[model samples]
Target: MGEAAENLNYDCNYNMFLAKIMLSNLSRPEDRQKAVKWMKKLATCNRSIEEMKLRNDFMYYLVVNIQQGELQPPFTDNPPTSPLPNIANLLPGGIAEVETNEMGEPSSTQQTKKPMLYENSPDGGAFLAAQPVPRCGAFCYLAVVAREPKHD
Candidate 1:
């Protein structure tokens, strides 16, 4: 087989191995619930194949080894927070979610509001729960800097 075909075969085998480990661990109720959750998340995601593979590998390790503090969730930097006044009710309908960042503080009694569809990012691309579409954006700001740049 050619190099690409060989690599594809290897990738398929690795993914199948990961899936086997994950499925075998699902005999427990908690593990089964978690597996279902991650499967749903993986299904809805628009991440690249490499990213999905990495997550599956982590999930496989999490299932087989069950390490402490290994898979710290990236979302919910919200400190053990009280819910926004009416937001809890809206959650069932998927209409509202809490907004949090360094600048904006969430208040327990804050009025209900629709979460912004998108927000500013450090890269100015997309919000936290989103996979940033690799964009070839303008680099005009770089022109103002006086530093010499390196080419890899």
Candidate 2:
């Protein structure tokens, strides 16, 4: 499995599968790092919507499972040798606006004005009655919240 993951020529999906296995075994930091590297690669590959969701799910879990202090940045501090393509440039009109912090990390403000249907419901809302919210989105949101510097 390790060999297959290291082989650059192997199918990315196959490598991702191997990495996922490695990710589940928390005892091995080296394996976890490798898994994270692949996760980042697969996430940014932009192959398909399904693939992107899968990668985000994996990353969401990773940030949730690992202790905050133990989690390391998957990539190095140095910028990429070649710049990554600006995704906004590919859009027709391009992004209208982006909010960033002093250090340039994206701000977590809600971008859309649309309200949830459940918010408008009266007493018996079916959507509001659903089981606990899905973890993928919540986990990522919580992880970011956890990292925020405490102002007070």
Candidate 3:
């Protein structure tokens, strides 16, 4: 379904409906995994996802599907290369520590503190967990994070 969304360039409402249905009916770990893959792919489709507006149902499912992949307790792993400063002000973060070289030194620096929102794994995988569970418990819904709004 995600592939279909990608193929369609997220341009069709019917395709969004189909993808939403597939995501809504997720019942197993593998199913969630697949859904997460689709969501992540959909979120980062080279800014193409920017044009895809979502309804409430689709937004809710997007959050749910991402929450499934998010590691319990939240991500504090390999920080984004250009992470925002003062992340502790954002959420109670966690990290997936990966050794830099064989010395076991943490690769992430203080300035590039990983956002508490998500983690990147050793294999260079990002967003294994759903993100944006803010400190106040408000959600950052995937659609908002997928892309920046165009300036006009």
Candidate 4:
């Protein structure tokens, strides 16, 4: 029993040592490729995912505009509100409805439907998990981290 315990300890130490070496060698092309492939496999096509990405991009644009002081706040008779223009009406699918006041001022009320992409998929996360990241652009190297192993 004592000898068996020592062997198990040695094996555990060896595996840990190997893992440390692997982590240290993460900058190697092979290691990077392995990580990239896994990432690509996990990150590929899905409508809800695409919508989320687009929403994040739009949010980034909004943040940039705000930081640059390009965004304007709405004027009010007694107080002030966000100067950002009402752009929900410009989106597609007729999913959003906007209402304006008699003074032609946006009231900041909109009825938005859940995006169809999100509604159709009950297990969107699992669906995304099962997809393979597409390689379509010069930066597809970034997506390689999400790809499934392709044996030839």
Candidate 5:
């Protein structure tokens, strides 16, 4: 693969393939390190937009794979309590009051709105009582609905 890549005059695709092989789990640590160096070189030596894009993609994969252990998520297992307002506080009549603009519209900064709730009963149980089993089954109803022409 390295010979083929070299013979191809450092073709982006062939070089990227070689780098992928080197970075694979079965490859030796030295080979993986060499792949990282080669990738960094390719990423910085792009002569065209297409090559730049391909190199950028490979670089992204290399960084994600090689530096995965160093990259910590924004949150931890026992993350500190978020300072942001709670969902309940964002609801209507909650502790936090939404500010309004001069036009009486909710301000852009405080745009929380009451969520739409759908329920067939006050207790919010099943949408409807079970009916007699259809002759064609539930899927037939879906097929029929799908076949209907759009009114618009």
Candidate 6:
């Protein structure tokens, strides 16, 4: 078989191995829930897959369409409101009671710290969960080098 065909077979085997590992690890309830959540997110979220083969002009159109309603438009200034009497305690002491021209609507400044999505995600207990094979490539390469026939 040609080298290209051999490489294609190798890639298929690797992907199948990955799928098996992912499926097996999803047996636990928490893990299964996480997997379901991620699958749903993948299905609904805005995923941008840009193929490098596309021409620049075509890519521009693809990007423009994706961004059609996503961007936020600019904001304009609002009119001022009447001053509140006896509200000096709200401001810091000793400094002049400098008031801003913006409206007196109760502006709520909220700072929310969102929790991490994958803090306890499992180690993906798959075949590759075993020590990562040497970077030079497959296990067969090391086997070949280790079992070289000795010549007298």
**Model 4 accuracy (lDDT, Cα):** 0.37
lDDT of 3 by residue, 9-113 (tens): 534434445555665455556555655554444444343333343322233344544446442221222222331223223233323333354565556554554
Q: lDDT tens digits, residues 18-119, model 4? A: 333444344444443443332232223123433334333333333333334332221101111222223343333222444667776656575545556546
Give RMSD (Å) of candidate 3 vs. truth: 19.6
Alpha-carbon lDDT of model 5: 0.43
Q: State the number of backbone clashes in model 4.
A: 16
Best by lDDT: 2
Ranking by lDDT: 2, 5, 3, 1, 4, 6
Please list the residue runs of candidate 2 whose C-alpha ends up more than 4 Å from where it truly belongs after superposition: 1-32, 68-152
Note the Cα lDDT for every prediction shown: 0.41, 0.45, 0.42, 0.37, 0.43, 0.31
Candidate 6: Cα lDDT at 9:
42
Worst 10 residues of 2 by lDDT: 72-81
Q: Write the per-residue lDDT of candidate 1 for residues 1-152, one digit (tens) a residue.
A: 35544444454456445554556544455554554455444333224455444444433443443222222231112211321122232223332345545555665565764444323334433333464433234322222436778989
After aligning candidate 5 to the native by TM-score, how far in Å is the CA of 152 from where it should be? 34
Rank candidates, TM-score, best first: 2, 1, 5, 3, 6, 4
Which candidate should be chosen as best, given TM-score against the real structure? 2
Backbone clashes for every candidate come to: 0, 0, 6, 16, 0, 0
What are the C-alpha RMSDs, in order, of all predicted structures?
14.4, 18.7, 19.6, 21.3, 21.3, 22.9
- TM-score comparison, 4 vs 5, better candidate: 5
Candidate 5, residue 58: the lDDT equals: 45
Error of 1 at 54 (Å): 4.0
Candidate 6: pairs in clash: none
Name the regions of candidate 6 deviating beyond 4 angstroms: 1-21, 50-152
- Residue 24 in candidate 4, Cα distance off native in Å: 43
For model 2, how big is the CA root-mean-square deviation? 18.7
